[model samples]
Target: MSTGVWIDQIGIDLDAGTQQVDEAIVVMHSAFVEYGHQGQASGAMVETADSLRAELSTGTRLGLARIGGQAVAMVKYRTADGGTLYFGRLAVSPEARGRGLASALVRALRGAARDMGLGGLSCSVRAAETRNIMIYEHLGMAIIGREDRRSLTGAVIPVVLMRDV
Candidate 1:
């Protein structure tokens, strides 16, 4: 298997199936399993492949990272009100954790935002997940504010809003 990671923006094909999409769904669900067990499952945990396909039909773009031609990490993003790229559901497979795959995906999305003339990158992280927040901080993002996001189970999750600085 190749040790190098490949990162890129994927254009969803609403009319046809794509391996990248399938791989992304697997990576997402697998990566979020911990959240599900913790009773704080994210909305992404409930998304079926078909639902994800529907979401992609709405112009949401995916950033994917692959190692050895196998998808290992993924992020979903869209342009928000302020011309900033609002990304979420960042997931890296357990086997790929600590390999810098998440960081690579973020960098790729940042480049994508720049290419689309977007102003900046933004995301919300569960406030309790300080490790994730720190990762974003290491990537040049900072906490701008906080908000409570209701999860699928109606649990109010405290999240911190972060933006590239």
Candidate 2:
């Protein structure tokens, strides 16, 4: 199926509680397992699930991209630096890979941030994750700082980027 068709098969909804977030967490864990071991670095931490659940339960905004009545992707953010939005834990399902879902989700997030009158959005990405770094750069994010020795989940990660809305 085409990208539009695949996207159309799903509904993007603002999840109201932790249940939906938990489901998305399951998918994300599995996806990481499938894609993580082969990468240059370890993937996300399973401990992140609890924090994600908490974020969903209490956050001002929580979104899920549901495909065929199932949560296939999730994106969430928080206000940082007073008005700067920090986005993290954006994940898409393995079954839904290469369908432009991540880009679509990020676009939606930028729109939401704009409507909220936020000055900009920021995220930290691993320097080794070239594909994701490329996507963020392509979306107009610019690197602002680099951390040399910090490890996100035991793997060296680098570079914080911010983009004005």
User: What TM-score does candidate 2 reach?
Assistant: 0.77
- Number of the predicted model whose TM-score against the real structure is largest: 1
Residue-level lDDT of model 1, residues 1-165, one tens digit each, is: 122234443222212233457778998989988987887777777877777777888977666676666777777888999789999999988998988777877777777678778887999999999999999999999999999999876789999999999
Q: lDDT tens digits, residues 81-115, model 2?
A: 75867776677888888877777767666666676
Q: What is the lDDT of residue 33 in candidate 2?
A: 68
The residue ranges of model 2 lying beyond 4 angstroms of the native Cα positions read 1-10, 39-43, 57-61, 148-155
Error of model 2, residue 123, in angstroms = 1.0
Candidate whose lDDT is highest? 1
